[model samples]
Target: MIDKVFPTPDEALHDVFDGATIMFGGFVTAGTPTNLILALQRRGTKGITGIANNIGLGDKLDVLCEQRQLAKMIATFAIRASGARQSLFEEQYRRGEVELELVPQGTFVERIRAAGAGIGGFLTRTGLGTLVQEGKQIVNVDGVDYLLEKPLRADFALIKAFKADRLGNLVYRGAGRNFNPAMATAADVVIAEVEHLVETGELDPETIGTPGVYVDRVVQCEPVPVRWYG
Candidate 1:
């Protein structure tokens, strides 16, 4: 018999070490794995390189920034458009305490998908003729320039889901599905924090966003109110 369910978030993340690259699945607070993030915060691992769509923006990930646990961030949005809502990540970035890699949102998701698909790299015109192309290889095809973007992979992926079975198949809800399925496929060890845990075969096959094969562990957590600011 195969079982991927874990009793707690901390146990599911026990193997995560210092200086590991991690993928965080979410768009702002939607689908964010707050329980797993909280567990990681409690574990106190440092020098993490986190890949996410946004660093803070009301997500619980800011606590990692406040704790100085992150060494670098590879994200699409790390700073707010207005200065009024400054995140700890932005403050650390401005102070030069942490490194930041600003990737275009489309490119970010594609890169992660490429990793799961086992592609070396891809060429795209998304960043051509801009600072985004700086330090990146550019290839010309038929007089058109395209920047080469490499795949993004991680040691661990922390994702959220609406429901998960003991076997680890995942079903997501609404905007909460954002990034969770893709991140589940792109990491070596994928841990899902779910609102409900059911027996195997409880989830409809058609509704499954992430297959059990891609998930290493599942942890059930209560639905918490989304916190937009710390």
Candidate 2:
């Protein structure tokens, strides 16, 4: 019997060490793996490099920022547009306590996807004439300039799912599916925090967003309230 289910988030993430690069699956607050983030917080591991679409912004990942556990962040959204609500990550970044790699949204996802697909890097014109092209290799093809973006991989990926089978086939709901599937494939270890855990055959094959092979562990957790939505 191949069972990937773990009793708790802590146990599922027991092997996560200090100075690990972790990919957090979410788009703002949606699909954020709150339980796993809490578990990692409890463990108090430091020097983490987190890759996410956004930092804090009502997501439980702010707790890590508050603890100064993150050494750096590679994300698309790390600060507020209006600068009204200052996130812990933004504060730390402004104070020079942590490093930030601000990547364009499309380029960010494509980098992670490239890692999963075994691609070395890609050339795109998305940021050809912007700061994003600085310090990056420039390639010219047909008299057009493109920036070379490297693949982004992580030591572990913490993802949230609507449901998962004991074997770890994941099914996501609505916006919750944002980065989970792609992150799952781009990490060395992938743990899923799901609302429901079902039997192996219960999940419909067509509905599975991340297959069991990509998932190393699965833990059931109660749905975290979406406070940002209120």
Candidate 3:
């Protein structure tokens, strides 16, 4: 089999096209593929639909929004985390220039999981009787009504991990593990960036969060400086 490792982040993302749907693995920027995102911003691909926990907290996804590279965002949290400071995504959304799909966190991840599992959709009451329920089909099961949330698959998935074997098995650190595994399975192409690249047998089989089967490409990237007591 051909090696899954790539020499650089841009090369890993070389096949990503304009108007592609992408899932970014990160929660509050802790496990984001910042380098790959930077390369993507430089690539100038437009009309991108991004699926992530948020637009970012002054991090990776925000820069993409500033460039207007992202045409739409399907996320649990968007600009609300910024408090008084609005992100570029919010500005574009306010002007009716970008499409936004605000989903509850649980439902958002569940939708992606459904896609990966080959399930049509799932029923959830998370957004019941709220604006989030709009346009969604409601089904009553056992006398309880729930809204149908469609699966959320993507064309490309950009994931981050602390360590990876040459074969692409991944090991995420702490909170960095949040969305990477699920996103990996939900995309047609998954490129994982790792801080540590080791031989194929280095990673303990049981500790690998994402197996090589789900990763198409792997690249080594500079590690993010973590602040523990901020």
Candidate 4:
């Protein structure tokens, strides 16, 4: 029953320094740690490498990109469809202020998982014949083509949860759970922000999606500003 709650988002992320590689959870902004992202924005930490499903839409995770705090982004989707907030990410890329590495969604998740599991490398058929194999090593297994993919690890993992126990056990609701769980195990440290915080025994053991062992810190966040996406 370790109480991991911090007084504020800034306090929870106190040790996060500049030039950190961060794995951010949420699929297209549904389960993003809005408060934590805001805290990082306010803290003004620079040279961050963010790994996520999408860079977020509109002002969702735009704080970092807008502030130029991000040095690079590793994600499945790098740009928005329409042109509203496009300037934020686009300007950075145009000026060579930020670097972006796009990967297939399935490859993205598996790479994180592989790193977390301590596997050296994995062979996948997902990107065997496309541009993904261009700069990568390709291997043949039983006459089938597969790419030898490297694992991805990070310095910190920022995740959002629907509910979290005092011990840092977490449960994510709906699609919010996407990259959070895999990011949880793949980083050196994990900071979780949740809407609800409960006592240690409040959550059922079988229901906990992320155990306390992988999470190092927790903070209770206010309702995030939900725009058209929510």
TM-scores for candidates 1 onward, in order: 0.96, 0.96, 0.94, 0.94
lDDT of 4 by residue, 124-161 (tens): 99977788788998888899878998899999998999
Greater TM-score among 1 and 4 belongs to: 1
What's the true lDDT of residue 133 in model 2?
A: 82
The prediction achieving the highest TM-score against the true structure is 2
Q: What value of lDDT does candidate 2 attain over all alpha carbons?
A: 0.91
Count backbone clashes in candidate 1: 1
lDDT of 3 by residue, 1-230 (tens): 54799999988888899999999998875888888888899888899999999875644687887778988899888766336667788878889988998899999999999999899999999999999999999999999999999999999999999999888899999988888899999999999989999988878898999989999999998965533221
Candidate 1 displacement at residue 141 in angstroms: 3.3
Task: Look at candidate 1 and tell me the lDDT of residue 160.
Answer: 97
Cα miss at 51, model 3 (Å)?
0.9
lDDT of 1 by residue, 1-230 (tens): 78999999999999999999999999988999998999999999999999999987867898997679999999999976676868788989989999999999989998999999899988899988788999999888899888999999999999999999999999999999888888998999999999999999778999998889999999999866776653
TM-score of 3: 0.94
- Go through the candidates in order and give each one's C-alpha lDDT: 0.91, 0.91, 0.87, 0.86
Return whichever of 2 and 4 wins on lDDT: 2
